[model samples]
Target: MAQGAALGCLTIASLVVARWGGPAVLGEYALLRVLPWLTGVIASAGLPVASTFFLAARTGSDPRLRPTLLTLALAGSAVGLLAWAVAVPLLHRLFFPDLSPGLLLLAGLTVATQLFTVWGKACCQGQADMLGANIVIVGEELLFLPAYWLVSHAGLHGITAVVVAMVGGGAAATALSVGRLAATGFFTGRAAPSLRLAREVVVFGARAQLGNLLWLVNLRLDFLILDALAGPAVLGIYAVASKFAELMRLPATAANYVLYPRFARAERVDTDAEVRRLLPRALALTALATPVLALAATIALPLLYGQAFRGAVLPACVLLVGLAVEGASAVASAYLWGIGRPGANSFAMGLGVVVTVALDLVLIPHHGAMGAAASSSAAYLATSAVLVGLTYRFSSTGRVSTVVASRAEPL
Candidate 1:
């Protein structure tokens, strides 16, 4: 429900942007965000995944684990802020075109605050405090919405408005998450981060982060390409379509929220059974939801974004199957990560990335957003197919049907 609400908030904000500024402005907003977002991905170093995994794996045996996560988040965010500042001179023009380099500072601060929420949620997941995790999501989205409202109503436009509002939301959300963490005794002990622990997180996190970074690129590479080849106005239209397509992902995203910590605590040997039980459910939900989401998007695109954005309808519909498959791919990726084989996950996403780049390059010139959607869908299908194959190979029974038949229960 919290995740749903967060998506709802995002949709509302997008609507406001589309209704107020049109696709060109929205496109600019999207492009402006990529820099800090990419930086955060690198700076995070997979700590969100690693912190949850290690903390849960410890089974509360290590009193210092909680504080160590805090330390890691702090150090990571600081590094990210510095990197974002440094990269401004070189990258702003290439990616953002005419935008000022100074805006990256605001973007960096927003992402830094977001890192705290990310770590806080990871810590909660490690502790199985699902409520806390949900609160973190809720607080950020809800707070950001009003900030965005204020900025928009004030007649602020473009990168400055979007990022300033993001900073407002992020800072407030960080305070909420940090206070929650402290109140819950997550910072109870004075556990300074040790080199051994840092190394452990780094070794494990680097592998997971590689897959994460690849997945991130696979997901967003088209946005950059679209911005470059088609320009921001076209990219803006595509962004709406992509956002609508994200509905198919909710089930898998929610599943991973619970599954990662649960899987991390289990032994690798029987992780296959866990996958069998959960993977089918996740895929089923994604499949069932996709067409419904497609239908809603078809109806809502014109209603919410006006006739100009009706073009997004086709592109969004095109993304459903691909995004559904991508949803399943994510669940499978979580399984691999939980079992300490993030390297395998990287292999699958890397192939998808190659496909994404090639097809996007080939398609975007002629067909624009439609071509990009088709390419994205194909790449997602490819990624999921390979990932599913990996899942089957890793499972001892070698066949999904065989395993289901071996059990008396229905999948």
Candidate 2:
């Protein structure tokens, strides 16, 4: 809860920067922000999912999981480096052609930053202290805000500096948190790295990475398309709206942190009964979160960003509907992935990503930011539907199946 509150505060400060900065600056900052998260998602892969289950299991019985966690981190780090080498140049030319060499260098650091931070967070979560994981998150935000403010005050060169700060902060925080965990003697076991366990974690992580990509595409493909079709300013508007929407999901995000490991433990105990007990409460929570978000986006958009941002209102509203769907889907996703159905989650996100790209091509050129919003919203809705359907079919409980069949049949 402290972490969540800190995040909420940090999120507000971020919005202040975005709101004050307006479209072009916000667009640039958005690019900076998205890169690390995208890389982090890739680096962490399915380990977050693996962490919840594996960690819960380890805490309960096996203490030999530390080496497995270390091995997974090393593997992810290697992959991250490779990904940075191949992906960053292409991405820079595509999304940030005017970027300075300094910003480019800073962006490169994201590969390492995401690798260490996400791996450590997953490890900590496995150790049942998600608070430690979130400390890194909030700490990064805290570091970036002030760092960027000071640097930008010095000169416009501040943007690159801010990016560097973010990367550095994540690395530092992760190191500290993980070191503290290690000092507790949790990772002192002389366990060998299990090829078998590594394979299982990597396989799941890879499958989950597919969904991660889809989510990446789903979340940002629209911005990329909008940037190409309309311009950065419009992308900026959508970016601001998207930031607020992320703020709205804080509750659901917090809940998932609590729920994933719990759900994982439950599945290990009895999959069917766990789903039966968890699904309704999850949906009910989603139900509660959606309208509050819609309301927040509605009220907060103008108030925070000023009348200049009134244009984001309609797009924000449209995006909130998509978020509502995604929220509901997240509940199901938590359970599905918890029970080891990452492939299903990946497949659903893949289909949704394809749909989003198709729609962006058709719609963004014609409609601009709002078009992007609609495309993204539709994609999330479809993705949510796919996840719910898959969860219902796969869940051992007739409960999820019945819920999908009766109340929320796919539209």
Candidate 3:
């Protein structure tokens, strides 16, 4: 709840900044805000999933895996930095053709912030410490809202301030989390006992990371395609539409956070039952929530983005349906990962990405944001179907376990 409120506050703050700073500034803000997500994903190196599973499995029990967790964090950070370096030139050419020199510096700073912050959060998640992670998130929101508010007053440079706050807060959280881990001897310089464990961890982490990358692209593909083919003005409308659609998931945010650990733990034991019980509940909730939120979005966007955005209503509605499919897919994905089959999950997401891109290519040049939504809706629905089928086939084979039987209850 606090997390959701914090996000709401940040959204409000950004909107205010947009109102004050004007649409052009808002466009810049949006770009700055969205671009770093790609870098953040690379920086975390899928440790969030691995660490959660690793820590939950050990927690009060095993002390040996601590070093491994620490090792992975460091490794993931390094990978993120490397990825940022590789991506900067390409992104600069694509998004900011006349990129300022200092912009690169700001991007570096943002990447640094994201790497440390996510590393810490992953560690806490591994330990099943959602409270600690949420505290860090709250801190980020508390800091960022005020920082953005003040930075908006500074004109163009204020955007830099927004970026800095993100990095600084993340760095602070990561440092604190890692410090605590070290104090607990979790990061002691110890030799990895077996090459097999390291290989398994890396393979799992990489596959999960790939799936995450695909997800990142899939979620933002509509906007990117719109911006590329339709123009900045249309991209702006699509962004607002996407935001409205994303708001529908607000209710499930808490459940989403809690579900990861549950899935991870379930997969550790009877993976199949865990998925079978969880998938339907997630799907039902998403289906129930979609239309209500879509109606709300249709009503809200005109009010929020002003009359200029009235055209986005239908696109928002389309995206809302896509978000529902994504919600169901999200739950089923947990089951896939739970059962040590992240590769299948990755393939599912990869397929969605391919489909979305193809649809965008075929439809966006002529149809604009509406076409993008169509692509997203079609692709995500297919992805959800694939994920559910794979999860059930893989995880629902054994005799009805107690946990599995209990999960038959619908939402």
User: Each prediction's TM-score against the native?
Assistant: 0.92, 0.85, 0.84
Per-residue C-alpha lDDT of model 3 across residues 116-178, encoded as one tens digit per residue: 566666666656666667766665555656555555465634345555555555456566655
For candidate 1, the per-residue lDDT at 169 reads: 79
In candidate 1, position 310 carries an lDDT of 85
Looking at model 2, residue 80 earns an lDDT score of 66
Judged by whole-model lDDT over C-alpha atoms, candidate 1 comes out at 0.77
Tens digits of lDDT, candidate 1, 149-189? 88878988766677778888788888988887787788877
Q: Compared to the true structure, candidate 3 yields what TM-score?
A: 0.84
Q: Lowest summed-lDDT stretch of 10 residues in model 2?
A: 402-411
Model 3 regions more than 4 Å off: 58-64, 154-161, 168-198, 251-253, 267-271, 398-411
Spell out the clash pairs found in candidate 3.
51-126, 52-126, 272-395
Every candidate's lDDT:
0.77, 0.67, 0.65
Residue-level lDDT tens digits of model 2 in 1-411: 645666665666557566556566667667766775566557656565565556665333455566776767666666766666667677777777667655675676666665566666666665667667666656655656665566567675535555655666556666665665676565787778767666666666767677777778998988777776676778778887776666546665666666666666653336556655666665566566767777777788778777777788778778877776554576667766666566778888998988898898988888888888899889988888888777667665443432222110111
Query: Could you say which candidate leads in lDDT?
Result: 1
